[model samples]
Target: MNKKSCLNCGHTISDEFCPHCGQKSDTARITVHSLIKNDILGSIWHVEAKFLHTLKNIVFRPGKTGMDYIAGKRIRYNNFISLLLVLFGFNVLSYHYYEKFAPAQPLTDDVIYVKDFFSKYSKIILFVIIPMLAINAYSLFRRIKLNIAEHFIIGTVSLLGILILFLLSDIVSLIGLWKPVEKIFNIIDKIIFGLSILFPAITYWTAFKNSYSKPGLLWRVSVLYVLMGIETLIITAVLYEIF
Candidate 1:
């Protein structure tokens, strides 16, 4: 048993926490040794637990994670900004891989391949992602009441899933599975491509149940469909220009 004192009023306390002043009775006189060891260790442990939990939840179940954060069950996860930074970095890298190596055209034997790849794919990635993310943001803004960052994370995770699917296809293509199942995967890919546009919309629906007074789901779906169509047109134009 450790004897402690309240920092305020100089009252002796039996436990680690002070009942009189409501401060930690274990707080010792500020010293270089204790400051570096005890304070830093405690803070680091608290932060580490939250960060790991957040990463785990985000990776395994993104929709639920967004719902949890929006419902004020935070402190079990990392804050939005930290997750965004990490996600953005990985997203950039993933973008490079998808645009470079996974397309119909191989990167080698053509200097123009890199430039053309970016020219064609960049706009699709941008326009589609932006509007979808916008819908996601507004949905959460109206419904579960999370900040912009949270909805963006939901969108990002969904897009990341699509990207992963594409990469998996690319790998299978290289491993001879593409030849055997090329036709089948192509059909599947087309379906996935269409559904990818609806990811953020679904995420919006799941995260925000009935917290907001707004238009019906049909209205929201219709609006998102129109935005997706516009994005599809923009991407088509960009591809045409590049090719």
Candidate 2:
């Protein structure tokens, strides 16, 4: 019998995968089921794996992870922009469902407007804010000597750490409990908030220490905290005016 030829480039091959074009020798005919399983389901699984791996690194080794990605070691990590978009999408959907089903007080017109505005413009806001924070980092850590783009990567990862903390807080809030459970949830909420702030600060500090030869960890962290506070104030003012 004649051996199968590569479907992709018509190269004659004997092994499972074609050496010339890398097409599988036993490539199956296209069908609805094949498309759904191979294309759709496979893509979803791949994305999920990458997302989970990236999240783990960002949570546990944020400084090293960002540095690795910037240095072009990114096969295992999800694309930074794609990760941010996915997180933002989750935020929007979770907030929408929470408002619809949760037993929360009716939102005031201003509050509702603010929520809607942020929901619609969250990506744009982040694009603007992240670069600004990157610039702030560059100015504050001039001794580190990282370029603007490198600092942007650090900013992106730091923000992702904060977003993950926010999601955890949201998840905790979803727990419906009686008096004792409610008290426990409240305590958890406070703890999550504290960690949200503390963790990101640590992420930046460690990233800086690893990226450059730095000594004054406390001084650098203090300056970063001050920059964050200033940025938060500016953002609050902008939102106040818009709403």
Candidate 3:
């Protein structure tokens, strides 16, 4: 390997990462631009950057991306959890702004309450359920050679895909929040609703398929699909009973 000096502790190094201080050998020098751009403003999150590059792969070839990641071919991709948390922060900010423009309505019935609850908090709920979802997936696909943490990686990526869909739908909703296209936005919202549910299962299916192509992969994924449906209904039922 080519040699370099560790910037933090002045140790000699021969790899991208320093073995002594564990810092990147090429850590950017601190400047006002670097400080705000790289760290806070996320200037590196552009489409041509590693984050969007990873997203492009995740959108098109999710399963293969997950497989390659777990197989240790991950030098090019950004951290999945970090990317998700960043996006979730955007999600929260967008909703908070949109909520300011909308009016409050009293919860008249259980159906309305559940629908409103999910309308505001579905992505957050889905994020909370990811660990449980990972457990469900691993239990169903026990034949695959993955531990819970590895299963969590797959689940996180799948949820990332769904979160993107939700944000897109919410953007449409936000536009309709002020515009006069109430009817059209209603249709679009319905479409977004369908896509949000379907895309996650599709993401999980493709990811699992690409990672391992064994017999019964189809049925295992199908079982997971059915379980997710049951889980959603159970949640709705529980919410109905509680509120």
Query: TM-score per candidate, in order?
Result: 0.49, 0.75, 0.71
Error of 1 at 84 (Å): 5.9
Which regions of candidate 1 fall more than 4 Å away from where they truly are? 1-61, 72-132, 135-169, 176-178, 181-188, 191-195, 210-215, 228-243
State, as a TM-score between 0 and 1, how close model 1 is to the true structure: 0.49
Across residues 1-243, which tens digit of lDDT does each residue of candidate 3 receive? 678788789999998888998987878778998788867677555534887788778767766777788899988888998889877877777777767777786666976866777776566467756786788888987767689988888878777777776677777778887658867987988887797676656666776664556556766777777887788778766765655
Compare candidates 1 and 3 on TM-score and give the better one. Answer: 3
Candidate with maximal TM-score: 2
lDDT of 1 by residue, 10-67 (tens): 7878886677777776665789888877789868988777776766565456677777
Evaluate all candidate structures by whole-model CA lDDT and list the values in order. Answer: 0.61, 0.79, 0.75
By TM-score rank, best first, the candidates go: 2, 3, 1
lDDT of 3: 0.75
What's every prediction's RMSD, in angstroms?
A: 7.7, 4.6, 4.5
**How far off is residue 115 in model 3, in Å?**
5.2
Judged by lDDT, which candidate is best?
A: 2
Stretch of 10 with least lDDT, candidate 2: 171-180
Q: Any runs in candidate 3 off by more than 4 Å, and if so which?
A: 1-7, 14-19, 22-48, 102-112, 115-124, 177-189, 210-215, 235-243
